[model samples]
Target: MTIAHQPLFKLCYDEPYLQGTLIERNNRFLCHVLLDGSPVSCHVPNTSRLTELLVPGAPVGILKASNPNRKTAYDLVTVEYKGTTVNLDSNLPNRFTQLLIEHNYFPEFRELKLLKPESTYLDSRFDFYWERESFLAKKDPASEPVNGNSCLYQADTLTENKFAGYIEVKGVNYVENGIAQFPGAPTIRGVKHLHTLMDAYDQGFDAAVIFIIQRSDAHIFRPHETMDPLFAATLRQAAAHGIKLLTASMVVQGKCVTPTLEGPTIDLNPV
Candidate 1:
């Protein structure tokens, strides 16, 4: 599908982001940055390894914490790498997916309204719970048409009935050679999410996982088999079970995050 370049979400800050240079990562959630020649602690929003993006002396954009009582006064939000601004916020993908669904960006999500965010299933809380308006209505055999023009019917071949489903969103920042990949490090939680989606599909509900590449340079997306072989294997299994795998790339310019005109294609199996 072709979509015009439009800002889906804006990264707003009450105070202007401070320009800084990376010093070192103290831990998974904390890092030290040289702001104005002085080293200061900053909060890292993502838990991934990010070895490619968070190298020492790399330029970064950090936002000061709103709360005065916070231990770390700044949050590292963006990293400049090879002329591309990569957003490091792990929470932004869900928001982007929500906006995309509201805008009817995905054909499978057409006519489907978001019922709730962070909706819970058996053992996992999904990013979204969505249902079609017709799904809530009583099923009528007489009202059903022999053939339909809706793309939902054509895309999802599981059921003729209306769509209702759970979606899990993943934010990807690691890209190499124009290919975006997820789980920069091993993630047990990521594997669990795939299992939850497969279980949802078995329960007769539409289940999907949407990966939002947090950079514009990527031409396609694939599971990081080398980083986390277990997660990659499970993702392949989920796709075989009819769980939808969706992806899109975004361009981050300053504070505005916009979707590219052409979305990234998914490559489940990659050499």
Candidate 2:
């Protein structure tokens, strides 16, 4: 999915955190400039991954989210500290969005009639639409209109209609040292999407959030509570309320992405 907002910092150099200190520690580096002025800290999710790109004395962007729960005012979302000024690899979450929509992992819903391949909406494009038909109560021959031939006749096609749905997909890649997990940090946006799906269900449509695990090591999916407790709570709520959550394990090497389902149906009903 597209970033709803822009970056807050340009680079990490001259940032308050590294103001007068020279790089002496093993973990610390003079990486880049933080011109976006977004309040930032070292403990944020996905931020640590940029260390490979944050070369000494380069330029990068820092965006801060206003979170009371955050230790620092900002969590670094992007960087241009590497050789190239633009880092396109930051869009991993957006790339696998379609795989999330089509497989009903998130119970993501969309109207089949309104869907087109690569159709863009809500800042992201989804996969194929999911459609299902629910039939009305069984028809009775005795209640049918009488035909002239003494045979009871009824309409073969019921007036009942089909249900439509829509959804956006996101790929999770912030697994640490090979452990596949979601929300390397607290994601308020993810919580918001869970709420959106719950609302969609109330509106008489099926909604889902599909997570495509790009690594082979992860055999199951679980909310990252340490990163974002609210997100985990919302996820449990979505399951209790009938929202569909799906996880697909995949093997990704280079540009190839293959699907492999290895878990039971995502159980949402409360025990």
Candidate 3:
């Protein structure tokens, strides 16, 4: 695929994000921030243990919660670090990747015509399910060419004879010395995803895991062996088994986030 000179995706909020100072993190999903000189509880969007980024008195950006029934009145989304804005939202990576696939950003997915998000395979639910146009046309010659606007084909309806692929997406925010690493905390589910991808590859289906680094400062991507050795080992095993491992860096400007034209290089070697 050609280099993307434009923004891959833009995450706009309904209201302007509020600037605040982070006080402390209470748990995985909760934090306290000083907004407008008042301490208020804010919802943390990420589940990972962001130990490095959630320091006390750190500058942060938050948005007002739209749901009236919600407990927290604001959601912490962005953190300023070393002159770079790092996005902490865990849900943005999948949406960003969906836009990338729709635009044919990855060469491996150029031939694929349709995309289904949150697709189930076996006991795991992958982030994306892609179908090739040629395969769809050959399966049903009377049907029109499959496009993004067409209805999504159910995974249950698809058989092994179909040509398709599965993609799992991971979001990254932790960076050290210009290297982006994944899984700030130990994650059992992450290792499971890697194993599932390997299983799909063994079954003759294309499988890949894309890591979206939510900061532009990272020049390379690698697994955080110190933080989670199991996850790192599984990632290496998946790579050895022919599962595609990809990484991309994103730049955050004000309230908008965009992918860089040139993606980051992946390094599987232990640090």
lDDT against the true structure, each candidate: 0.81, 0.44, 0.84
Candidates 1 and 3 compared by lDDT, better number: 3
lDDT minimum window of 10 residues, candidate 2:
16-25
How many pairs collide in each candidate, listed in order? 0, 30, 0
Candidate number that wins on TM-score, 1 or 2:
1
Best model number under TM-score: 3
Q: How many backbone collisions does model 2 have?
A: 30
Residue-wise lDDT of candidate 3 within 81-125, one digit each (tens)?
Answer: 988899998988998888777777888888677788887766788
Best by lDDT: 3
lDDT string, candidate 2, 13-76, tens digits: 1222222111111243222233445323432234323333444444433433446685455333
List where candidate 2 sits over 4 angstroms from the true fold.
Answer: 1-162, 176-179, 261-271
TM-score of 1: 0.87
Better of 1 and 3 by TM-score: 3
- In the predicted model 1, the residue pairs found to clash are none
Error of 3 at 248 (Å): 1.1
Q: What is the lDDT of residue 72 in candidate 3?
A: 92
The TM-score of predicted model 3 comes to: 0.88
In order of appearance, the predictions have TM-scores of 0.87, 0.47, 0.88
